[model samples]
Target: MQRKSWKKPALIVAVLVAVAMVTSFCRSRETAPAHGNGAPAAVPIRVAAAHRGDLDLTLKVIGRAEAYSTVNVQARVSGQLQELLFKPGGHVKQGDTIIRIDPSLLQAQLDQALGNLAKDEAQLVNAQAVLKRYSLLIGKGYVSQSDYDTYKANEGLYLASVKADKAAVELARTELSYAQIQAPFDGIAGAPLVYPGAQVTANDTSIVVLNQIHPIHITFSIPETGLAGTQASMARGTVPVTATLPGTKLPPMQAELDFINNAVDITTSTIQLKARYDNHDDHLTPGQFVEVVLPTTRLTNVVTVPVVALQNSPLGSFVFVVNADDTVQQRMVSAGPSSNGQIVIEKGLSGDERVVTDGQLLLVDGARVRIVTGNG
Candidate 1:
């Protein structure tokens, strides 16, 4: 009986030990690391090949639209406003009649001046006849020399009077012409500041404002560093410019760079530039703000990469280039002017390497990579 009981207890202990061993073994298998063949997983990335191409260095800036010419039409003669030739906010051509002042008083003054001139001329003619007679009498001793001399002096004074009266008539005519105001250029006229029948004084009353919309001017500024390139390009030919209005569906306005400021602005550290556009459609208006795209220079046969591939570090900018072994190597790079979503690789690139564009944050020097796209 004692042998049988010991055998039963040994069997129970054996079963418990076996059960524990099986559970531990299963747990070990569940916790074991798996990385697609027991190696660290390669990071999947998108890349682009650095290639030689022409890159245009375009500078975009905020610019303001301005009228090519602006003028404040002012009254040039004192008179009552009789009629306005143009309606408020109307278009006018150069030399178009814009305003008409009351001409009744001006005409009367002109007539009186003309009468005075005619009267002086008649007296001058009479004086000449008398002077001729006096000369003949003085030579023949028919009249005293002092009397003949008086007649000659009187004749000269009458001639002087005739010239003065003629000048007065011309002055009256000029004054009359001022009563009619004409537009100085082709432009859009603003609201009349003075109404009809109101007495307006010369140079003291604001009549209307004229703004030339066609071939408008746009003014913007650029950094001083770009000044040399802009001037160089301008010297070759017309530097092209493009301007767009924010939040508008209108097409960009084409312009030509025309004016460069002689001096740089000290406070802003930027040089001002002006471009002219043929705004025949009247799309651009005076005092409107716009976006200006200025092309500073064009580079040829330059190595370029997407700007996203560049990584910054304590040392400097860098990029990860893929090698034949499907591994990435970190290369220090010198970056130059960036435009149109690409950055110019100034150094440390040979224009034939595949640079990682996406998934860069997951990479390290000499890291293994699986190119998901752009692999040849």
Candidate 2:
């Protein structure tokens, strides 16, 4: 009876111990974190705020510099270059003598023409006197009508000869004046193409190149989308433009829009335009490539955002805005022209809202977020 009673007590303690172990194992399985078989999520990138300021809408483009006036100084008359009056690469004014072709031959021709004209004039006077005598003789019946007609014909021939001689004299004078080549405008003369005593012919290589530097031109092209804005600004009044030298981060020089193409270029799909600058210092040179900036209309009190904050999806463009309660809201936005790396938000954002610029791609709508201190 004592052995039976000891076996029942030991079995009850073993049953209780097994029940406690099973209960503990069940609790641990319920409370532990679940494991995933996939890769970890990407970490959000920290970014700073871009302060809003007065933003100017500037259209940037690459362009080439051009001279407002370019002239190739060619000789109008063929002759030996007698003298180079202006120094090469020096400034010249309008009507300033540049090259002096040998005028001796032209002067001789003029003299010959003048002598011929004088001889013709003397002959014409003698013929008029003979015609007058013939008329008087015919009136008095001293000469036949046929003789008078012949005398009148001879007088007409002499008059025509005198007129022709006068024309030759004028032609000779014009040729003589052309022997002196002069500058056509105020400009800098390029290198002399012919040396002294070099024979030059009309329509051959130019004697020199002249470029007007005081007023210069900058030509550039803009995208077709910006055409309306440009036309509006131009219609309102004069619009200011600027240009800077390529490869040089220099401050832009001011210019005025002087010309705009009537139609877009079919090949480039861009609108060609030109601006005039008063380059009094002669700093701008022809053929120098540059960057052109045309200022368009300004947006007033519009929300502006950093470019990186904007995300692209199949639906449209969106941005992740962090709310006050430390959560993100996906907001769709309409964008406008971007300037200085910042974009103009046309819709879907208020100036008071805070946006996630750097870590937008990692966020989702209603995502829990922690406001990073000093990360603004």
TM-scores for every candidate against the unseen true structure: 0.74, 0.68
Report the lDDT tens digits of candidate 1 across residue range 106-216. 999999999999998998899899989888878888999899888889889999999999899999999999899999888889888989989999898888899987779
Screening candidate 2 with a backbone cut-off below 3 angstroms (N, C-alpha, C), the clashing residue pairs are: none
Clashing pairs in 1: none
Compared with the true structure, what per-residue lDDT tens digits does model 2 show for residues 1-376? Answer: 8768899889999999999999999997777644344323333544445345556677988887787899988887888889999888888989988889999989999999999999989988998999898887788889999988888888898899999999999999999998898888888888888798898896774788899877888989998888888887888788899888766766679999988999999998899999998988776888888888897665566678888877888988878887676677888888777876788877888666777866665677986565554644
Q: Which has the greatest TM-score?
A: 1
lDDT on C-alpha atoms for all candidate structures: 0.91, 0.81
Count clashes in each candidate, considering only residues at least 3 apart in sequence or on different chains.
Answer: 0, 0
